[model samples]
Every structure is written in C-alpha cells, then in structure tokens.
Target: MAIPDGLDRIELTGLRGFGHHGVFDHERRDGQEFGVDVVLGLDLTAAGTTDDLAETVHYGELADSIHGVLVGPPVDLIETLALRMVDLCLTDARVQWASVTVHKPNAPITPTFTDVAVTIERSRR
Candidate 1:
C-alpha cells in the first residue's frame, strides 16, 4: 500500500548487521553484512508542537529493535526479513504505515552487482 498522505516520515537508513540468512549452505555458515532502511509514517504534530520526546517515536529505540530482529533467528529470504521489519514498525501505535527495505550486498550471484534488496510496505488498517 502507498504511504498515507499528510504523514511525516522518520527515516533510518544504512543500519547494518550480520546475519546467516540465505539459501546456500555456505551463506548460512558464514554470515554476511546486511543493510536495513526503514521509513516510518506518522503524524508529527504532537511532537512538533509540544517538543516532547514522548510525543514522537524514539528512533534510537526503533533502530535497536530492528537490529535485534536482524541478529535474531536465521531466515532463508530477505523477503521474510523485510516483512518482520514491517511488523516491528507497525508495533508503534504512532506509526500509520511503514516502508522497509533489506539490502543484501554480498548476494550469491554470478555476475557482479552493487546490491540486492527486498522492500515491503505495510499499513495499519
């Protein structure tokens, strides 16, 4: 789904972690670096007006939470990782929607490539 209109975004990009997530045995044995980007859509009116930390989602906590997921159980697909991130983002009641991207830079591909990524968008409905 598209991000709702009139919502402000808190973007956390290039959060890195190591994970044993891949289909190949070698990949599972030797963990690799992964990058995560999250765009959280929320109404920032309260925080903007009041200048209160409680009025907004704490990005540091969110980043740590996402990193926890990244370092947690092994998964076979980046798609699954992305979905888990979306779920995490939606846990915050203030978030109206979330766009998550999981980037696998060292994907097992024959041809040289810059990166491989999976993106998922989820909304609170």
Candidate 2:
C-alpha cells in the first residue's frame, strides 16, 4: 500500500508500566502500575523503499526510554508526565508526529475503578 509522501506509522501498545505520580499524596508515595500506548507518524519515504534501519525511527529504544520516564523520579502531576513523554518523542529524528496515551490502573481514588488514562498528540510544524 502506498502511504503519503510524508507519512509513516508505528504503533506500540500494552507496554507494562509503573509510576508513583499523581496529585494525591498516597498516589505519590505508594506508586502505581500504568500502561502506555503510542503511535508515531512520520516520513518514511526513504526508509520504506531502502529498507534501512538507520533511516527509520527505532521504536524499541523509544519504548524503553518512555518506560524509564514513567518509573523514574516521582512527579506530582500526570500532565507533567504526559508532557515529558511528548518531549521525548520530539527528540527523535524520524518522529515528526506522535500520539501518546498513559493509563493508570491502581490510582488512589475512593471509588473502585478499572483505569484512568490521558492521551495527547503532537506534530512538527
């Protein structure tokens, strides 16, 4: 199938996660397991035709880095965490656009729930 001249796709989902970040004190202190899914859109004209790894985005490395950020130093806000994740994607050379979702399953709320999540998308101008 022929994609557009300036668009490629990479999707990663069900990546196991951990984080101690939230507005509540318990959430910050106790930490929680989260899930992340991301889809990166960028130019793959050269890589797709040439079959070169260097010319494409390294999805494995990107996932690992995002995993690191989620489990790293405790932050107080999911918004900040989301932004940090976006920043990481923007640093990659091949990723011209991306969509990110962070899911919190063990959130410290009074009521029982399945999960809480946030999603954001960005692209170079």
Candidate 3:
C-alpha cells in the first residue's frame, strides 16, 4: 500500500548487525553482517509541538529492537527478516506504515556480486 498522506517520515539507515539467515547450512553456521534500512510513516506534529519523546518513536529503542530481531534467530530468507523488522516498526500506535530493507552483503554465490537484499512494506490494518 502507498504511504498515507500527511505522514511525516523518520528514516534509519545502515543499521548493521550479525545474523545467521540464509538457505544454506554454511550460511547459518557462519554468521555474517547484515544491514537494515527502515522508513516509518507517522504524524510527528504532536512531538514537534510538545517536545516530548513519548509523542514519537524512540529511534534508539527501535534500533535495539531491530538489532534483536537481526541477531536473535536464524531464518531461511531475508524476506522473513525484513517482515519481522517491519512488524516491530508497527508496534507503535502512531506509525501509519513501515518500510524495511534487509541487506546481505556476503551471500553465498559463485558470481561476484556486491550484495543481496529484500525489502517489504506494511501498513496498519
């Protein structure tokens, strides 16, 4: 779905963590660095006016949450990892939508490739 109109954007980029997420056994056994980028759509008017941390998402905490998801468990696909991160973004009531990108720079491939990634978007129902 498209991002809702009038929603402010809070973006976090290059969030790096170590994870064991891949389709191969060696990938799961030997963890590699992963990167994540997130974009949150929400109304920040209250936070702007009130100057209160509670009125908006605490990005540090959000980072921690994302990091936990990245490092907590092994998954077969980056798509699943992206989905989990997006779910964390929607935990806050004010978030109208979230976009997540999961990056795997060390994917096991014969050809020389810079990176592989999966991205997903979700909105509140």
Best by TM-score: 1
When sorted by lDDT, best at the front, the candidate numbers are 1, 3, 2
Model 3: runs farther than 4 Å from truth?
none
Instruction: List ranges where model 2 is wrong by over 4 Å.
Output: 1-6
Q: How far is candidate 1 from the true structure (C-alpha RMSD, Å)?
A: 0.9
Superposed by TM-score, candidate 3 places the C-alpha of residue 2 at a distance from the truth, in angstroms, of: 5.0
lDDT of each: 0.94, 0.80, 0.93
> Quick one: ranking by TM-score, best first?
1, 3, 2
TM-score of each: 0.96, 0.86, 0.95
Model 1: CA > 4 A from native: none
After the best TM-score superposition of candidate 1, give how far the Cα of residue 72 lies from its true spot, in angstroms. Answer: 1.2
Q: What is the C-alpha lDDT profile of model 1 across 1-125, one tens digit per residue?
A: 66799999999999999999999999899999999999999999999999999999999999999999898899999999999999999988999999999999999999999999999998885
Per-model RMSD to reference: 0.9, 3.4, 1.2
lDDT measured at residue 46 in model 2 versus the true structure, 0 to 100: 86
The clash tally of candidate 3 reads 0
Per lDDT, the best of the predicted structures is 1
Q: Write the residue-wise lDDT of candidate 2 on 1-125 in tens digits.
A: 22234677888897777788888888777778888888788887888899998988888898899899889988877667777887888898778787778888776777989988888777775
Model 2: residue 22 alpha-carbon error in angstroms: 1.5
**Residue pairs in steric clash, candidate 2?**
none
